[model samples]
Target: MRSFVRVAERGSLSSVAREYGVGQSTITRHVAELEQALGVTLLNRTTRRITLTAEGARYLDDTRTILRLVDEAADGVRSATDRLTGTVRISCTAALGVRHVADILFAFQDRHPGVCVDFRLSDVQIDLVREGVDVAIRLGALSDSSMQRKQIGASRRILVASKEYLDRHGRPDEPGALARHAIIRMSNVSGSDRLVLHRANAEPSILPVGDRLLVDHGLAARRAIMMGRGIAPTHLWLVNDLLEAGIVEQVLPDYSPEPVPLSILFVPGRARVKRVRALIDALHGALRALPGMT
Candidate 1:
């Protein structure tokens, strides 16, 4: 299981084998043997990337849980093992990875010096099996398919404008009025297909609006909105600090967004593992402890 986890985390068969002082072919043989034992193919090998099959993805989550238990038991022979002594390879978007996720990870490392973390931050989507990332913090809604996920945090899209911009143009009274305002927006595969604006008791209205500034990254969009360049439909979590500082005002409050959100995604086997479980549980505990969670 450790070898399998290491290969999955490292992504390249050769890389994991080299780390363990073996040839790539040997690592390949080991993975093949494991796959045969499980009666499932875990990776779809390609020249460019290794993709996880649904079965493989599911296996990873559980494998993670099993590994943690084994480690915890080993630790019980001596220490309590608050120091979860191993390397955790995590991947998340560039912006949040640096600002928020990295903070939490670094703190985890500090408290558990026996454990090391290998983190990769990028805006691009990655294949977990191929990239060898143990966990991926993905933003926005999930797909209409079968990948396991947990809520690391809850996030929503809100209309926001700089104080200067709101003062100059006035806040939007309703979703319909946004048509007349300049907007900065993010449209990606991970984001919603259409925008839904909600009021307290009334049904939410869907809008098809154009953007003066269109970006794929949340951080850049947030920066533009903070500068008062244009009003923006943004990820609430990314702009939480700015909103609190009174630098940005929430507009169209009555017509807030519906249930678009943020989540942590991984192959199911990883979620079942002890180290991964520890991280997932820590995230779940931390997030639920946040204000205004449903």
Candidate 2:
């Protein structure tokens, strides 16, 4: 059942075999034997890829639930004689993971020595169930309504550039002046070509800005800003230390980008597991305490 669930999620028998440190033939036999017992085909196989059948798809959901319940039961039994033990898998946005979440995980592991962490970092939104991820630390507005989420904080974004760049290029006195200066943009986000700024008593200013360089990651954009490349609107958490050190200065200080919500999303079944619950509680508190997360 375990092997089948992994094979279903990963879509490859060989990959599951490698993960289990076994031969592909062994995994093939396991699936074949299971199918024989059930008298139903679970997958459609071809030379290049595998696809789950209609029945298989339904079975997959039930199988995952069964596996989760079994693990929960085992953990409940073990808690009587041992310290908390089990792996907690987490997925987080890349920049935040590198800057803060990794440190939080280290501290968590230090406190719960028997617990193991499987951490994954990516800027792209991934399907939690398909990837077998227990929880994801996400930024920006969430679109999925069905998933369980806990809003930890909000990420405030602001326009910023290094002093060296502004010294040579001059500062913009108004939002309209941004068109005359180079801007660094995040390529993956929609509307990277524009800046929307807000102030206390005035209407929001939407300005078109030309990109001098395009980067997909927050850290890359920060490096470009540090190298005096161009001005960028960035999450404060991504560059707070640099700002404090005076390595970068806020542009158009009175105006700011709309703050985006930061949340921890989890699979409903997985959140009930003890280790997963513990990690989520730790992260909710720690991430809320990060600089620029309000």
Candidate 3:
């Protein structure tokens, strides 16, 4: 089972053999024997990469489950003091990871000294299970199935502008007044509907925020805002530094949207190993130091 799984995961007989302290032909024979025993051709040999057959694809999930159970049974007896190893893949936004999660991950690595993490940074919203992500630092609300969420912090979508820009153009008195001004639209959002604005002392105004200027990355949007180009509805964390530095200031405070929950997400069926939990706790600790959550 070990030889079969290793070769499949590594996608190379020689690589697996080297890692497992065995000869290449030995791994090849073991895989062949396993395939024969299961009566399925599990691997298609190739120089570059291997693609699983339909039968192999079906078997791989089951194989992973069996192996996980075996490992847990062994570890349960040894207890957590035995130390945790292997990797946890976390998908998160690029801006947030750099601004915040990176430090927490470094702290986790320092404390654990055994577990390693693969932090995938992207703005794309994806399924954790299908992408082989052990965890996700998800922004906004999640409406997916078969996943649990734990809130580490909270953030509201706030409108922002550089002090210089506000000084030149003057801050708008109300949401409807934004029509006369330029705005930064993020291409990062999945939904394309107009932004809905709510004011504490006035009626809600739903503005069809058009594409005056589109920025793909969050940091780019921050730069545009800092350059006095346009006002942006941005996550508070991304603009925290700029706000403190007086490069940007909050606008339309009364009309800012409801605070969005920041969550650490995990898929079902995988072992909630001690290392995964430790990393999540570390993230929570870091986020607690931020303004809104604190």
Badly placed stretches (over 4 Å) of model 1 are 1-82, 143-148, 189-194, 269-273, 290-292
Candidate 2 — which pairs collide? none
Q: Model 2: per-residue lDDT, tens digit, 20-49?
A: 789999999998887898899998999999
After superposition on all CA atoms, how large is the RMSD of candidate 3? Answer: 4.5
TM agreement with the true structure for every prediction: 0.71, 0.93, 0.79
Candidates arranged by lDDT, highest first: 2, 3, 1
Candidate 1 lDDT tens digits, 1-294: 656777767667777887678888888898899999989899889997676789887888788788667755755553553446666678788766755777777676666676667888888778776566768877665662445787655665677899999898877776777777777767653334456777787887987757456777767887888889877766666778898999999887766665445677776565655566667666566555433345
Residues 104-211 of candidate 3 have per-residue lDDT tens digits of: 888888877778788899888887754667788888888886897778767767899999999999999888788877888887675433677777777777887778
Q: Whose lDDT is higher: candidate 1's or candidate 3's?
A: 3
lDDT of 1 at 130: 59
Off by over 4 Å in 2: 53-55
Worst 10 residues of 1 by lDDT: 285-294
